[model samples]
Target: MAKKLEYKDLLAAGVHFGHLKRKWNPKMAPYIFMEKNGIHLIDINKTLVALDEAAKAMKGVVRSNKKVLFVATKKQAREIVEQVAKRTGMPYVTERWLGGMLTNFSTIRKSIKKLNSLEKLMKSESYENLTKRERLMMERKKEKMEKVLGGILEMNRLPGALFIVDIHREHIALAEAKRLGIPVFAMVDTDSDPTSVDYPIPANDDAYKSIELIVNYIGDVIEEAQQERKQEKEAQKLQAEENKKRAMDEGADLENAPESHDEEE
Candidate 1:
């Protein structure tokens, strides 16, 4: 069994540290423990509870076979989140968060389709026959699109949930998710409003250790759920095959059995 998150673990990761008291948002008072040296200390107990809640919710989302889009554009969180997202096989946005990423998904799909076609063209013989200048233009266009759309290249539909690093910095992403009625899970600091997200894990979003600890835990939960979903599909397939084989055997038995004749006086 995997190890559960402990209060000491969170403490070591600096998850209990929050922003300056003056910069704190009043809406996050419930999760604030107290002020020390002008910095608000997040309630470790509350943080643990919130983390558990968010993990459970995300597990359900992944188990349902729906994607969870990970968004972390901050310097401290981008690489950590990208690695976790890739390991979990989920779509992620470590680059700029386009305004209509979730709200106006149709346009994004068009861009993705174009990127696909461009890639195909580049691989075809016709691409080489083009002039040097034309080739350079196509390459630059492809590069620009890839930088923004690479993480979501395989995402063909809206995600079931969005996991964000900082709600304050990624407000646009949060807004787009809310506009589309998508659930959001995020690490909300003292400077941000926790109520803005569906599942808020209060922690020091700026710390590399803090972000890594929480994000890795969530990734593990998703991986476990994915494994369970795969097992369920395999089990269902096996049961179906067994039922079909049984029916076939029963039919064969009936066909080989001698037919009963009515007795005559």
Candidate 2:
């Protein structure tokens, strides 16, 4: 089992409500309070079940080596998404989601392949051995192209599941995932419709602290799954080695028995 990341630790890490607190939006107060206090306004029992389901789904994804797309449109969400991605070693979409990212994954993969090829070429002796001025020019050109293809290159492939911070703003990505038959897990705000998502974690999306807490929790689940997989592999290897040794020992015993049989004859 993975070590649980405490909510207090996340708070200590300075996950707080963003500038929206000062903004005059009556609709945002509930979310803001929920975030600050790490409270879930929804049914606590149902929320626990939902979290467990999400964790199980995440485990399945990790077992299958499926990619998860972490997305957020708001500034706080963007930060939380980045943290989640970093912790889980998954890809994220902090910037806007490109149209057809899920449906047109092959094209995006090709772009990633191209970028990899270019990166390789740039690192090769032939490229590196060029005149200083020529190398600098080539690097500059590569940087420009990389910047242009940043979004596609960052993702490089379709995600098996989508994790969104703000479902309302990232509706297009969710819709595309639905169209492509991908599962979605999101931190749904009260004003947002939870029915749209496959796994809706109804919580305070407005509060930076709350968002970070939830995202971090999910990220911890993924890391735990990864560690479990690693341990399983090690155990299999050890079992195989033990079987091999046992087989050798049995063979030796059989060989000795033959000598005893010869003596009896």
Candidate 3:
């Protein structure tokens, strides 16, 4: 099981920002630091509440077998999001979001199917059946096909929910989710508005460590729910097998029962 994130851990992550040691120009500091208006940071209470809500919502989605999409536009957040997806077994968008990935899922799925077919054909050594030039042409075609469908293949299906590292850059994805009535969870820095998201966990989105901490926390919740479901399934299967054995044993006992001795008289 993954450990719960603590306030101290978050504060420790903030230390990574100390690299901004160079004298801050009034113009640059505003962009570098998480701030809005005169405020430099988000309220701790709000962040805590948001984190709790997001974690609970993630657990619910995992238990219900809903798909969750992790999105990140920044390099640092992208790395963290990728790690989170691996940990939680969820789909993610580390590269740019494809415009109609969710709305036009059927088309994307078809493309993915075609890519799979091509892959199988290439692996079948059927190339030997073709002339040298023909084989080279086929190989080039395969490479182009893979590049086109690479991102689509990463996604298994439309996401039930979305977790975005940056709300602004990933607005298209967020908007699609809203139109489809899918829930969204995101890390809203001080400058970003949290109202758009269903569950907004405010934190230092610019800090690599801070982003990782939040992503890992949510991933842990998802993993825990998955484990719980797996255990429940195992228990149910065990109970079913035991019941079958008990029924069989009772039937055998009945068949072996001694007949009434009254006939001996």
C-alpha lDDT (0 to 100) for residue 115 of candidate 2: 75
Q: Cα lDDT of model 3 overall?
A: 0.73
Q: If scored against the real structure, what TM-score would every candidate get?
A: 0.94, 0.71, 0.77
Model 1, residue 48: C-alpha shift (Å): 1.5
Across 221-259, the per-residue lDDT of candidate 3 in tens digits comes to 888889988988899999999999999999999999998
Q: Give the TM-score of candidate 3.
A: 0.77
For residues 112-227, what per-residue lDDT tens digits would candidate 1 score against the true structure? 99999999999999999999999999999999999899999999899999999999999999999988889999999999999889999999999999999999999888998898
Q: Backbone clashes per model, in order?
A: 0, 0, 0
Ranking by TM-score: 1, 3, 2
lDDT of 2 by residue, 55-139 (tens): 8998888877777888886887776677678777788777667676677878767766777887898888888678999978878
- The numbered model that scores best in TM-score is 1
- Choose the strongest candidate by lDDT: 1
Q: Which model, 2 or 3, shows the larger TM-score?
A: 3
Model 3 lDDT, residue 236, Cα: 94
- In candidate 2 the C-alpha lDDT for residue 252 amounts to 91
Worst 10 residues of 3 by lDDT: 15-24
